[model samples]
Target chain A: MRFWQLASFGGFLLLLPLILGLNDYYIFLTTLILLYTVIVMAWYFIGGLAGQLDLGAGAYHGLGAVVTGYLMIYYNVSGWIGLVLGGLAAMGVAFIVGFPSFRFGLKEVWYALASLGLVLILQKIFLLWTDVAGPLERYIPFREFDPLYMRARAKWFYYYITLGLLLITFYLAHRAKRGKLGLYLVSIRDEEEAAEMLGIDTRRYKLVALLTYSFITAVTGGIYASMVGFYHPILFDGWIGIQTATIAIVGGLGHFWGPPLTSVILLSIAEYLRINLGGTIPGLHQVIFGAILITAILFKPAGIGPYLESLIEKVRKR
Target chain B: MDLLIDFAISLARNVVLGIMMGSVYALAAMGLALLFGVANLINFAHGEYVMLAMYMAYFFSVTLVIDPVVSSIINIPLFFLIGLVTYFLFFKRVINAPPLSQIAVTVGVVVLLRNIALVIWQAEPKAPPFTIFSASYEMGPITIPLDKLFATIISITSLILLYLFLERSKFGTAMRAAADDVDAVSMMGIDTGRLFLLTLGISMMLVGLSGSLIMMYQAVTPTSGLLFGLLSWAIVALAGLGSIRGIYLAAVIFGLADALASGMWDPRGREIILYGLFILILWLKPRGLWGRR
Candidate 1:
């Protein structure tokens, strides 16, 4: 990474707690933003790089949450171990769906629809799998603050952990974007036939992209379940999928730094809207938020990424 | 044999309802099919246009105390103008843009329209004022609604008119030519831009008509478009991309399938059955029932 990028990220981390100390509400908002940032970065692997719009992030997220919940409840596993197992299970499911989709030449809308179906299917499964999943929210045992169980009584710990995860996900995305795999994926996105003609193993590369995406998203899910201390079918709702796509698109999709930036700005705006408009008007906040999205899309379809890049270019020229 | 008779009666009632429901599906899918077939845009926000039509219907009913049936006539032209404006403002610029960008734009529209509805109307479900014809009529162990019958008739008549317009008229021919190959049609001295706007206007008007008709039987809400949108997508996909008659046939089949599943199983399982069929159909025949290879 560039010197400015590293310095900015480091400064943000160092200053996050200091800012959080100012208000409890800001801490909660910061943690939520970090969690969504993790999910958006995960989406970038397949959506931004491979150009496959997988609308089924909720499926992997839900699966990871269910796995963590089950491990914690039945087997009494530590949250740390549960997180790893949750990620593995999510990856296993991704491979099953991704392999068939890639091999069969499903691209664009077909892939988007198929991935959407995965979330619906998983939601049903979680609903019916009453024994392990439980009908209501499954809670992890509350204990004193422990790094081993990954359970914390305060928001400060979650803030740091989520920040750490965000950094790792950023690094991974940056590496992929700079690597040969990134080149192949971009080629597939731009023109599949030409890429194949140029001897790119499109299917293999896509599968790799999908696996990486699922693993990162699943990890986010694990952290989410622990932080919230509950898991339910509602966690995998279709709206979540829509929100994932919205965050990525709004942030300037296909850019290395876009998703996180978008997540922070949009989530904060949504929270602000909810706080102000939600009490008096039940759904007005959503209305204004939706309007913002529509205006952004109508006017700034390339997202804030290209605009920011141009601004940087102008500065360099000066 | 009474059991058999009951089953037969139930099936007949459902079949009629399915056909009635299919008419609305046909209208909703027409605009999306036109856009996808001609311009190759999936248009994730296509349902929002339908929602907009419903709100328009509600507005006319509430303000002018006009019957929804009468308001639908007004909506046709009004929504057509809105569609035209939308095309000029947003879609026209991105006609040949990348698919991801197209999806993003439409999704943004969907979010904006849905949120607009929430702001203006709140989330409370609203229904357009209905006349006596909106109620159900009992015919000796079977129930049928007059509004649904009217909706079906109007739907079929409009579709037939659309078919004639597309197949026989010069402008329709120009639109078809543009859809087949925009560059080639432009080379042949046709204005492809005008054709796109025309297609968009007509398609959105059809969706507006369906929205008015749908309010006769079901209540309208902000999120109501989500199910209808998905159903229309399923119908269009099943019918093949560009075939009007195919959309009609596919909608009928899907409506019947949906009715049958609801009758045979719990209502909650209806989505599962429909989506399962969608996956199976795509797996077995990716081009759709009538889609060209």
Candidate 2:
């Protein structure tokens, strides 16, 4: 993390609390953004840094939400315990899916399809598992703004929780990027053959990246489910899978702050477009979303993150 | 003995239905295989191309009172041109980029094209006017829809034609050679770029044909491409990477599995079985059942 990044983090943290008091809608939107940022950051671990196109985050997210929501609703489990257990459950699934994928040489398109298949499979399971979670919606009981219970009245409570998770992710991501694991993962990502030849346990490191990323994303999913007070099988959706990948890519691969930065800009624009034109024009937002991706790929293949970083570096040199 | 006879009869029905459905899948998978072989690109937008062809067939039938089958025939040349233009404009730019970028570019095409269709046509399911042989045919206890029989016949004929083209034609031989070794074919003075463009064009034309074949039975919708697209993905995976014969066999198997599962349980259960089988195949045999490394 650089001075600018730290400064920005500090600035956002300081400003967010003040902004929360202004309006409920702003708080709700910011809270959603914060949650997505956590997801995008988790996605960056495997997608941007490890260089794997695992589209299975939605699988983990849905798993975490289902597990946590189920436990809290039926077993009366505390949201805190549910959060950890949800993460573990998702991690377990990540191993089941990621083990063969990495152990064998499933790279690029195959990996993507495999991950996507996992999401669909999980969604089907949840949809059909009527004894547990079915096509019907499941809701969590809400309490009066109780942060300890993870049941909050005001949206700001969820905002703070998501912010805390974001900070922890930022710290972990920052450390990994600077440390040895980051180098190993990056080497494996850039060229798996050369990395393996150089004695790097490419499969093991890829598994580690996947497991860690899955755990954090699941925890966030639990938080999201609690905040929304409901869960559905569609929680394991293709849209979120695409959105997370898009954010990571648009943020620019291999940049720590890229996903978060892209999340704020792109998601805000998407939300704005949805609100304004969504009523009149069906599928219009998707058209614009795709257009943005095409423009990004055509013009800035390196991504907005690296572009911003270089710009800052030039300014500093001057 | 009665119970046993009933079960046997049901199984036979499913098997026959599966084969019919599988033939359609094979027809779609052939286009995907051709593109993958010649261009080494999976064309995620292949489904959208199919969707566009269906829409074209629908409008042509609705406005001009042409038969759906004939409209699809007319769509082939236009779809081929669209494929060529899309490649030159979008896919050509990302031919050398990493797989993620390649996937992203195609995904963008999927979103753009699908949404564009939505904007133009709305989300309503549309079909041509009623025609003869739209009802089901009964043979003993087994019943098969007439539209499905026609679709299966058309799809099988197209696959056979594709097989002959690849086996006998000069351009087909060139495409096969390029699939095997791009550089070697280029060294032999073949214009690989034009070959790729031609491959994409033909691939789109085939998908358009497949779309029209199904238009007689299946209602055309903007989002129908997504389901068929994923189904084709599963088919391609099951068929292995570049094996045309394997695609046909795999498509039959997939079609059979879908029919049997839905018949035995429910429609949703069929999806679970199909996707479960897909993941299992990817895990156990990444190269597919018949594909060599």
lDDT of 1 by residue, B81-197 (tens): 988888977788778888877777777677778877887887889986655576788998889889888888888998999889989999888877766777898898877778788
Instruction: List, in the given order, the native-contact fraction of each candidate.
Output: 0.42, 0.60
Docking class for model 2 is: medium
Q: What does the lDDT come to for candidate 1?
A: 0.80
Q: Give model 1's clash tally.
A: 1
Quote the positional error of residue A153 for candidate 1 in Å: 3.4
TM-score of each: 0.91, 0.94
Model 2 agreement with the true structure over A1-318: per-residue lDDT tens digits: 699998996887767857567576777777777787888998878987789988788888998899889998898887888889999999999998889888777888778777877888888888899978999999888788666667777777777778888889988988888999999999998888999999999999999899999999899889889988999998987667767886788788878887789888888887788778778998898789889987786678788899899999999999
How much lDDT does each candidate structure score?
Answer: 0.80, 0.83
Query: In order, what DockQ does each candidate have?
Result: 0.43, 0.66
The residue-by-residue lDDT of candidate 2 on B1-293, one tens digit each, is: 99999998889888988888888878777888788767888677777878888888888878888777877778888889898899887888876577677787787787788888888889998876754557898999998888778888888787778888888999899998988888999999999888989998888888888877778767888877766777788888887756677888999999999889888677787777887788778777888777754
